[model samples]
Target: MPWLATAVTTVGLLSTGAAHADTFVPLPGGEISRTLGDGTVVTVRLVGESATISPSMGATPVHRNAWVSGRAEVQVAGGIKKGSIQPGYVVGCQVDIAGGGVDGGASGKTDWEGNASGGLTSGGNLSLGPGEATSFVILDRESANDYGDESHSSANSFKGSEASVTWADSTIGLSGCAGYAQARAFVKVKVQTETIRTVVTLWGQPFSLG
Candidate 1:
């Protein structure tokens, strides 16, 4: 299965330019920078997920039927405040640049959910065993203020000093959510309003899980 990370990397980084004349000229180390029509520059930085869970033994009574569920929520920086995100930028399931130097942020939830469900039918005792796991993440980016003083909303959980995941090898957990065997969810944003040309690099990764 092509890890959802790829989708995150592709759509997460440069999906808006996929249709228009916006060509995604790959930058060194999967980085790309481009200026929109207005004169605002947005930089793309693909950070990796950190948290992981190794395949291990789960609570078991060797029962014929058992079930379980797990969930996780990640915290990200930036919100409906100035400097939190590029002025006049919009964010959604897929990051889209609507031209201009503004940073428009989309409103909604910022949590990714996944689960693993199955049944342990042994000895014909009629037992169903289901398990689930969830996690959270924090994405941070550097914004240049060369274009003057800009304001940004602050996210509830965007403030903090946390470690990041460097690679995708970090196993998170199992998924039982229909069509989520390989699930990937995250937040994205687009830059619209700006005064001068500056660079903003997105940075974040899933939190760790034992």
Candidate 2:
């Protein structure tokens, strides 16, 4: 199985030019950028992302499984407000399987609902393990902590300091969620203060995983 980073694939960064929303462009090494309506820019450069599929180690023989993991450095610059009341940009990733897990079709869903950590290299070295969460989820922490950098956010851990964040590897064992699929790392910005109401997001190009 070969890794499909954006640099080598035809599925390059694509975004909407419309003025109503944010812009997204895929970058190399799973990187992506989102420009907000207020001219604020949030960049998320993925150091690496990976996925694994295998028979479950659980005693239950009825299911197989796949685990998806992502890691990246994030930052915010220009037009960012300080001490805003709304939740700031959210940096995270998700998995979209072709087979759709155990159901193997339209009935399958997205989201891995796992715990996330913040740092400079939290998810960069994650690997499939015997014990893992049942689904994928966004990184959630009450404070704004950088991966030892100078970043700050009102509601997320990735505010200041080009913090590193990761959605630790999680399992998707339904038949519909099995097989090869695309994994996407993305960023979202939401600032709802008394003066500005901007919501924008940028999704990095998808990569192959099985």
Candidate 3:
């Protein structure tokens, strides 16, 4: 894992004669390798992760906003090479999301759904009170189904041994939370081999939303 110091800069001024600053946080993305029952090794990597925290347009203490970016890569070896990757983020309002009760490694089988303190949403814009959290997928790809009907999916499928997904400037807006807030990124990969199928997840470092 590679770590970089976080950087903050004053981007502009607010309407209330207050100096508004945007915080740029450089995250140390991670990598993890998992071995399947059939001796297949699946590797997941998260790279170039960062977030820009900006003051919300509401300009109130209860409102927060951020722009996140990252890249997720997957490589499968020694088995049938087909997999899917889903990238997402979890936002917490006054709730501990610092990998508590979860494996604190480059990759882990953390139960994201169980750890979430609130209901999940399809989009980034959210509202939560204290001690609540939610997760949302970043990709909403639009495509035609087999019958030529419009469809939307959050995961991207790929064949062969290697595939990657990149996202930039994904918006996260939170309101109704009057306390401190935090967020973390995750990449979930599902791999299928001739003998078995497995899923691996990679979690990024948690960052503040103040």
Which candidate gets the maximum TM-score versus the true structure?
Answer: 3
Candidate 3 per-residue lDDT over residues 73-137, each given as its tens digit: 88877766566777888888999888732232222222322222233244678898999887777
lDDT of 1 at 159: 18
Q: Which has the higher lDDT value, candidate number 1 or candidate number 3?
A: 3
> Clash number for every model?
49, 26, 0
**Position 132, candidate 2: lDDT:** 23
| RMSD of each predicted structure | 18.5, 15.1, 7.6
Against the unseen true structure, what C-alpha lDDT does each candidate score? 0.23, 0.34, 0.74
lDDT of 2 by residue, 52-82 (tens): 5444434243333444445545555664443
TM-score of each predicted structure versus truth: 0.27, 0.41, 0.81
Ten contiguous residues minimizing lDDT sum, candidate 3: 1-10
Expressed as tens digits, the lDDT of each residue in 1-210 for candidate 1 is 111111111011112332322221111122345554554444444432222222222322221111111111222222211112211111111112223111222222322110111221111112112332222222222233458744222122211211122222211222222211212223233322334323244423212111
